[model samples]
Target: MHLHCYSWTGAGDDLRREGERRPPLPPGDLAAFRASPLPPMRTCDWLLKPATRIDTSPPTVTEAQTWLADRYGTAEPSFLHPADEARIGLDLRLKIAEESLAGGTDVLWGIWLKAGGFICLVVVCCSPNRHADYPCPCRLTSP
Candidate 1:
């Protein structure tokens, strides 16, 4: 499985490209994501750097999500609103519940408001689901 995330524009070009699959975010998030600030390049340079050799085999989604949750507590409120659950017309409630057992890793993002930087972490750690857009396949529950 592959993962992709977005970092704000303030990041150095080389820094943003450090990861294997850093997919560009949607237009709306892109603007906000790019406007964000990043920590000192040197501080995270080692982490952001690309690996010497690509590893086609990576940890499973569940393993990755577990690692992330352990490192960063479930960041649910940022990507999903409480109201989106009941109000949503789709039948994703069950999926949401299951995915959230460990944490909201399937569809999660990291946003830095003060500095204005964003990174999207894709959770390919679970059974494949087509809903790439977080909070399900439809627009945010019209609330």
Candidate 2:
């Protein structure tokens, strides 16, 4: 079995492609930032849709990150270049999660399970403080 927690932009770019860190907004730019249209968090519905079952209850963000860290052997995951396939692991997950809570792209988190090289299950988690434009799917009783 292969397991990992992955994070990506809703637009489907590699996590490392977040480009340069965003600069601090000037006082006058506050209005622009406020007026900017932010999309609802990308729930990674593609992963959720085909499930025979989905466990809405997910581990906490720290728990999820730790899971990856333990498995990948990285105690402190710093933002670095993505692997050849653009797969996201602990580092990108942490960065995206932080950016999401700070009013950037609505990042989503999920635990991915693969067995025999085939994806088998996914567990979606609620965003930090439930800061989502839509209801928290993770809190749903049913898929």
Give per-residue CA lDDT, model 1, range 28-140, as digits (tens): 33322222233212211212222221112134444444444432333333323335433642235334523653442334433332233333333332222333323221222
- Kindly provide the TM-score of model 2 when superposed on the true structure, using C-alpha atoms: 0.28
What's the lDDT for all of these models? 0.32, 0.32
List, residue by residue over 19-100, the lDDT tens digit for candidate 2.
2222123322232222222211233332222122232333454454454444344312322332521466557766665444
Count clashing pairs, candidate 1. Answer: 8
TM-score, one value per model: 0.27, 0.28
Runs off by more than 4 Å, candidate 1: 1-61, 71-106, 125-143
Backbone clash count, each prediction separately: 8, 0
TM-score leader: 2
